[model samples]
Target chain A: MLPVRAGIGLRHPHHREFLERQPPIGFVEVHSENFFGDGGRDLDVLGRVRADHAVSLHGVGLSLGRADGVDPAHLQRLARLVARIEPAVVSDHLCWGAIGDAHWNDLLPLPMTPAALDVVATAVSRVQDTLRRPILVENVSAYVQPDLADAMPEAEFVAQLVARTGCGLLLDLNNVYVNALNHGFDAQTAIDAMPAVAVRELHLAGHFVGPDCVIDHHGDRVCDAVWALHARFVAQHGARPTLIEWDTDLPTLDVLLEEAAHAQRILDRTRESVDA
Target chain B: MRDALAHWQRAFGAAIDGAATLPALRGDAATVARRFGVYRNNVRLARMAALRNAYPVIAALVGDAFFDGLARRFASTYASTAGDLNAYGAAFDAFLAAFEPAQALPYLPDVARLERAVHVAWSAADSAPFDVARLASLDAAAQAALRFTVRPGAHALVSRWPIAAIWNAHQPDAPHGFDFDAASPPYFALVRRDATRVRVDTLDAAAHALFVASAGGAPLADALDAVVAAAPHADAGVVLGTALRDGWFDDAPAG
Candidate 1:
């Protein structure tokens, strides 16, 4: 498969534009939960796009962090979708979104404990087994770091997940950037400690600067610092399939493509450097 | 480990309720509270945003402040049961019906019902229209005896207010000065996706009666008779023809 040069996180607002004029980009990704229904217009549109573009299924609602066994029904739905779409890459956040039956519908952090690690590892294995394919787990931006997680740093937690499940990592550089500022850690250090061999893909997105810290809102262009971090990531990991995600208050397709093109240029430069 | 998981779940729930912070398990109390606070905020924001997106008309009808408050209340009470937020607000219509603040807006429940229908129809399922050729191949007797099922994407909604008109008026291209009279008689609306577009049509009394009967498994002839009885001058041929053209039926004749 051609490497994921640069893709955009497809949103509903841009559906008409995408359908009308198939924009030039490396690939496109979508939130898996948005298409979880038995059948509907959403499925119809997705089917139309699947024929034209290399699509990726990036799930946001799997709640993989919940201690309860993964929801069998959700797994079955995702399995059916994967069978239907046969996306290039299937991914979900490395965060939990539910507790028992009550789903929070947000990516919640799991404490970095041996017990939590065991639970998360088991969940990933089960999901991979059911889907009959290896899945990539992406690190999410954190607003608060739990006390219990002190025993294990974020990088170690990610490395352990990759070790246990043999799943690839979608290192979201912007998330690391956001968390670094919010939690007062060095972003590059975190990236350096990650198991580079397992890093199969990278994510670049815009974030909002809040009063106390930055939030990974994915609503703007890639910041100077995040782009710098992306350059550093490519230096170590080579040119992986990098996705440019812009979720809230999305700009026109042209703007998003421009942002992606910038990433592509950086990737090309990094490839040259590595070749030398 | 299970005990810790349970405590975490409880603490998270309490945090949403503003009853307690995430308890310090292996770190400082302030850090735990702040970190856990992020999860709590995310849960509330995501669910609320989904509700707003699904019920934009409802949000517009009720001002932003009112809608946000209602959304918060619904989130705290229901707590999303499904991992998919697309299926999050299944109970919002009923909740709105009983909400004291919304009681004055009598048409609010119907609007909520319509919004839910749109959401369901949007994600219900992809289906090809019942093959016209198959229906034509059936003899007159077979056609009369045929029992058809609506595909998963099919939806039928009945409202006591002019909800269809109200819903259309809220669309992006709607004209100004569109007002609904609360005293208008109940309206029956049918929504189904031809493919990607949700087509909402208003059903006359006769067509509505026939559909409701057929949906309950009545035979075609009986349903026609019922339609004729309800509206003596109603054209059964026109109604059935429109339904067929709209791909409402999912099958032809059963052997």
Candidate 2:
């Protein structure tokens, strides 16, 4: 098994470079939907990468928040991919991206009410049963609060979800940072309340600061505050697998590796402190 | 909660439409509205960007501003049905066909169709190329009776306008002095991956006819006859030879 060190989100731009020189990182992750096709350059490149490193399948779609039943076609495609890739970990966001037949194509937030919880938990449980594996569900960075949601805090909602479903948690420290800043909450408090045993992975990505909100854009380097939260997460969780995801305007491979190395050093230091 | 979900959905829709004030919800209404708005923006941006990426020629034909407007309108009207954004723009060609503003550009629909084909081909499933050597071992009669399937990722696109030529000229390294009118009449294009790069080839009349016939499961002899009939002046032997060499066929014709 690959250790709990920093990995980079493998985007198309960096595919060729990684092929030529397999960089030294903890592991690599790719958007599962990107490889949903049968045969193509995307699949070809991904196949090559799988041969060389431990890969994690991160899904952007799957719409776990929808009130309707899980999309059978989407689950079938994901199942076919899991059989083929045999990834170390598989994950999707806790937010919904589709409603009935209409897909919004974005990670839309869910109401934290009991009704919404039942809907999302049922969806996640169905997916886990189908895949016969405990998939990790990542907390999405939200921009707004719905009126019908239960007054419970986001951390309490997440904890409730972990208790209801056996699925592991993919604690996105960056999302915690973004939501904390946007909604005027403490990022550390959210992290501290996370059910530590349910957390199997961590994600640290950059966000785009908008006029009214800080968006989880994943298009730049991890911010200082997000890094600090990530370090704190490692201290709390004992070095779970962390991924540095940069989707748009991706920098050179060296720059991404440097970011990963920074995270790796933090994890190493934390591990040393624990041993001492 | 149900009402709240509906309200959030509507607010998200309104926000994307550039509405100023969203309806108040139950929780932190302001925060909910803001988050919903952020999602709306991301949805619009991502879907429009996918359309632009898949249909670059359409974006080029209609300037960036016009394309952006069209993308936004299309996204709001045509609800995406699949989890994958790549699967979002299937109706774009038909949408373009009926779009009032684009009606003047009669060729735009066909161009959009070709672009969709290229996008689909780029993401289609992988399959092994047909084995020519294995086919050579079959008896002549069996060969004539064979039914061959095109590779899963291979797509045949036929358009009345010179759309493939338009697509080819937009390649990253295309020559600056290329002329669209210099290209011949309506042509058939075979879009498929050659190793890693997506390669587009303008198929002759006979090859196109053969591909269409074989795609419909016609036997080799019947398909060859249709090809010869479609382009009486073209050489069927050379067309088949080229197609076989290009990894277009998926298997030996079924006897």
Quantify all predictions' global Cα lDDT against the true fold: 0.80, 0.81
lDDT of 2 at A200: 85
Q: Over 4 Å off in model 2, which ranges?
A: A149-151, B1-35, B60-66, B100-105, B179-184, B252-255
What is the Cα-based TM-score of model 1? 0.93
**In model 1, what are the clashing residue pairs, if there are any?**
A39-B124, A39-B125, A39-B126, A40-B125, A40-B126, A144-B35, A147-B27
Model 2 over residues A1-276: C-alpha lDDT tens digits? 345778989988898899999888889999999899877788888888998788999999998877775798999999888888888888998887776666777887777777777877898898888888888899998777555535466667778888898788888999988988977888898789888878888888889998877888888899899888888877876898888888877899888898899889989989999999
Q: Write the per-residue lDDT of candidate 1 for residues A1-276, one digit (tens) a residue.
A: 326488888888888889998988888899988888877667878888989888899998776777776789998999999998899889998877777677777776666777677877998999999998899989988776655533487678888898889899888999988988987789999889898888878899999886655778889999999899888788867888888899878899889889889998988998889779
Runs in model 1 with CA error above 4 Å?
A: A1-4, B25-36, B131-136, B175-184, B252-255
Fnat of candidate 1 is 0.70
Q: For each candidate, how many residue pairs have backbone atoms clashing (under 3 Å)?
A: 7, 16
Model 2 over residues B1-255: C-alpha lDDT tens digits?
A: 655665666565456556777644444655566565766677778889788988988998888999998898897777677899888888999999999998888888988888888888887766677888877888988888888988775778887777777778777787764555535666787777655567777777888898999888898889889989999987887778888898887854454
DockQ of candidates 1 onward, in order? 0.59, 0.56
Error of 2 at A226 (Å): 2.0
Each prediction's RMSD to truth: 2.5, 2.7
Best by DockQ: 1
